[model samples]
Target chain A: MKHNFGAGPCILPKEVFQEASQAVIEFNNTGLSILEISHRSKEFEQVVIEAEALVRELLHVPENYSVLFLQGGASQQFAMVPMNLLPEGGKAAYLDTGVWASKAAKEASKLGNVEIVASSSDKNYTYIPQGFSVPSDAAYFHFTSNNTIYGTEIFEKPAVGIPTVVDMSSDILSRVINVADYDLIYAGAQKNMGPAGVTLVIVKNELFGKSGRTVPTIFDYQAHAKAGSMYNTPPVYSIYVSMLNLRWLKAKGGVEVIEQENIIKARTLYDEIDRNPFFKGTANVEDRSRMNITFVMDTPEQEAAFLNLAKERGLVGIKGHRSVGGFRASVYNALTISSINALVDTMREFEEKTK
Target chain B: MKHNFGAGPCILPKEVFQEASQAVIEFNNTGLSILEISHRSKEFEQVVIEAEALVRELLHVPENYSVLFLQGGASQQFAMVPMNLLPEGGKAAYLDTGVWASKAAKEASKLGNVEIVASSSDKNYTYIPQGFSVPSDAAYFHFTSNNTIYGTEIFEKPAVGIPTVVDMSSDILSRVINVADYDLIYAGAQKNMGPAGVTLVIVKNELFGKSGRTVPTIFDYQAHAKAGSMYNTPPVYSIYVSMLNLRWLKAKGGVEVIEQENIIKARTLYDEIDRNPFFKGTANVEDRSRMNITFVMDTPEQEAAFLNLAKERGLVGIKGHRSVGGFRASVYNALTISSINALVDTMREFEEKTK
Candidate 1:
């Protein structure tokens, strides 16, 4: 079994994959393939409801929030956030900590005014910006919880007094979260959830319809919430797979339990990097991500040699994002402790052989 | 096996279902589930490209058109059509044939002027409105070629001088279409293609950028077409299942052979409805859809009693749409001749019991 550490479409539980494969064959023994069953059927509706219920149970989502599994990814939300919240002639504040955060601001720029309150671009986004006060007059303060490309995570939700929104695409369910901390939380399902297709959106109901323009119904959260995300045919397979993955997460003692395991995985790799003179960690230790551990070797040749060694040991997708290249080990909830250990052994053996 | 008559996601070949199920467990034997592989990976990129190619080959699409597999269902396309095609202050004509067509018009009304050139709502949408003229000054003529609820279909494209737009959600691929007749064609994948979640949009590359507003990248046709529908993580499972189904379609001799089989299946059911004293088809005989065959019994009791019998005989999803309270047997391309024969036998047996 190869160790997969690709960023986004990272990893999932084997049992979930097995169950999903069975569903694709015959869901509830209905004799109809899951791919060909009606989305309006009772069998499929249960999947949607169960997925939403799991999200609520795992995260302790408050009653005021409406959880939606909508089409389009985080990129679509980049445009939808401004279209739904930034009223005509209104301004919004955003934090720029990575490529995705900057992309979100760019999409919002076409809708209304977006002011960058703080940015870590000067340091190549190696660390999360801190201690910047959000403008009280802005429509909402938006930020990304984790920088996937640069391996940085904001440990605490910014205490922005205004309505706060978060694009938690990469680190949503990796740890415990107080749903009330933000007015809206959005994430693409490719990371910890299931697959790429449906996006998860948790929005406080009161923060809608304030945008001055007539929002398209498909893009309107109120429309999706009212219809329970069935305004049309949803991506049924994506939702079903996600339900399986979440059910597995809950079975493994929920996010609280998973977070501890994640901390161990992160520490194991970071400690190895710190102990070995040949390796160096990329992000500031204080702002390092528990989900993605980014690191570099002393030289390009050494980095290439280490990658070849990792490959020989069945490690795959460990390559970092091309823009910030070296290596990234994405230890999502589904990535096992044993896989990380194997990767660690690969690195140690390479060091011993070279020395 | 039960006969499925639900409107979409309806029936698909068992072979396609099996292949899709296997893909979920282990795609291309890469030890990674199809749901876990990166979309940018060469393995998945081929799936996207091949699906587009099959769409073009089966539909005989013109060289000038671009095919896209996009997130969101046909309802999203309802709004996207206008957002992408209708210019500010520009009027477009429409044929409001049924609930879907009216909904499309409603969405278009939010974007620009949508003139309902003709409608059959006055008659409960029992027949297709014909001989209506498309305005030369209008942006384009929009119409739903098949009405799943009303069970009516336009046998021939309206001879319009302006550009044409078609929402072929429920009936595409059941029959052949002249690619040159329309400026754009959009369909939800649940019906004739694959599953819900991914919509198929085929557009003439030129009729873009005329919509006076800056369309959000997610809704912008030009943006999606340019990016090959990977502007973000697409519904990967949906697209992969679609490819498997399309490959099956091609192996069965493409649309020509499939359409012939579809006709035989429709004929078997429609013949029984017309010949039996206890039942009658509701659609105009000339305009009745070979895709969705709408019918009624001699009385409500007979309809209810027959539905019970059909259920007992393992028939699934034969209930009529609520608005039209008879029964609709949606026999899309994937439904088999033997399945329709079984439905016909059930109806005949019920008649014999009542008589």
Candidate 2:
């Protein structure tokens, strides 16, 4: 058994994997591999419907919102959000929390005027910026809710008077959020949802066509909503596997139940970091992420030694982003408390060895 | 034994499915689900490299062309082709063979001026238009190589003298093609390549960054090519499975061997359609697609009865598109000669029952 702490394209339930794997061979006893079935077929149409419904239920998304399963990841959404929301010559306010946040602002700037309301870039994005006001005249306020690389997250949706859009790619479905608070929420479903193909977009229906730009039909949210996320052939197997994982999430008592487990998991690992002498947490204490827990050692040699030990014990994907050297154990919703214990045990083992 | 005749998201080799399903559970003995591994990992980096290499080997793609595994299907490419190739105020010429072809032109029209050099819509797109002159001044000439819905195909690349782009969504790897002739060739992997979610783009390196328009980074071909399709986390499992399918294709003696099989399979089915008194082929004989074979009965009742008979014989997804209002048997590369014989035998059984 391995404890996978990879950030994005990360772990899902073993049950989900078993079922998903089975479907690749024979889907629903339909005498067809899920990979080969037509996206237009009733069976696949139901997969999309159920996946959408699960998102709505898990997040408590309002009826006015459209849940879309799209492609191209959050990188595509960076451009699409601006294209669909920022009108010609309109300005959009952005809070740059990390690389992803900065990229979002940069992409938006290409379409129209963009104002960086706040940025944590000065300190290598170690914390989410605070006490910054979003420009009221801006068409929309955009921010990254979770910074996977920097090990920081903005838990509270900023009370900006303008429409709010958040990139929840790393932390979506791991915790609860009020869907009504944001005009749009987009996430690449690799982190907590399922895998690395489909993107989840939950946008308020009223926000449609507000940009007044000739958005490509494929990029337009309204076109996807009107067509029920079947504007064209969607990532069929990805969406289908996502549906299976969503079903798994729903069975595990939905997001509320998972949120409490996530809190415990983060706290357990963070407690070990605080208690251990050889290791140190990187993010500011107040803004430390509950998903990706970044940490480092006093020396590169020590860090490498710990990583080797972690590997010997079946701990994989704990290496940190190059921008923030050391280790990042991404403990998403699917990661169990036992895995947290295993990591804590390893950290203690490292301390004992060092002593 | 089910013979899937779905137009797209169609069949792949049984061996590919077996290997793909196993990888999902435990990818390459890594003790991690394929769905969970980090895209930045060396393991997955190898998957992308091998997939690209296999494509180059199978298609005999020149070193000057970059093979990209992208998302959002060919629909996204319809816009990206224009965004990347058609300069601001420049004109692109298009050949309208069916819905997909027209849609491609329509998307391009939004980005720059598009000229419909020719269209076969006069005969309900039953035939491919010939003797059309493409404007020499156009930035690019775009056409759909295979019309899945209309059951028509253009096997030859028309000499247009401009940057030629073809959407070979349905017939890409079923036969050999000169990659040097076309400036850009894209195909949704569902038909002849792999499954849905991932799209294959073989673009000449010289065509990059010539649009003179500020294309979104995600939509820009140069960005994708430079990053080696790792511009963002690609559809991981989709690409992995495609690699498996491509490996299967290579092991089965590459495109040359499969082309012969496809030819024999198509001829066997088309022969049955021609000989059967109760059925008639829909598309023009000269332009009939080797991949998607469309045909119809004289009456709706007869068509319905034949469809029922086909389903009973474990032949699925043979029902044609509503636009064509007939039966469309999509015999992709993975579809065996036995499947063709089964479809033909079913057609003969229908004729005998009717008599």
Candidate whose TM-score is highest? 2
Best by DockQ: 2
Model 2, runs deviating above 4 Å: none
TM-score of chain A of each: 0.99, 0.99
The residue-level lDDT of candidate 1 at A189 comes to 94
- Global Cα RMSD, each model: 1.2, 0.8
- Across B228-298, the per-residue lDDT of candidate 1 in tens digits comes to 98888888888998898899999999999998898888888888998899888888888899999998877
Predicted model with the maximum lDDT: 2
TM-score of chain B of each: 0.98, 0.99
lDDT score for candidate 1 against the true structure: 0.89
lDDT of 2 by residue, A26-109 (tens): 999899999988899999999999999999999999999999999999999999999999999999999999888989999988
Where model 1 places Cα greater than 4 Å from the true spot, the runs are: none
List lDDT for all candidates, in order: 0.89, 0.93
All candidates' TM-scores? 0.98, 0.99
Q: Each model's number of backbone clashes? A: 0, 0
User: Which pairs of residues clash in candidate 1, taking residues 3 or more apart in a chain or in different chains?
Assistant: none
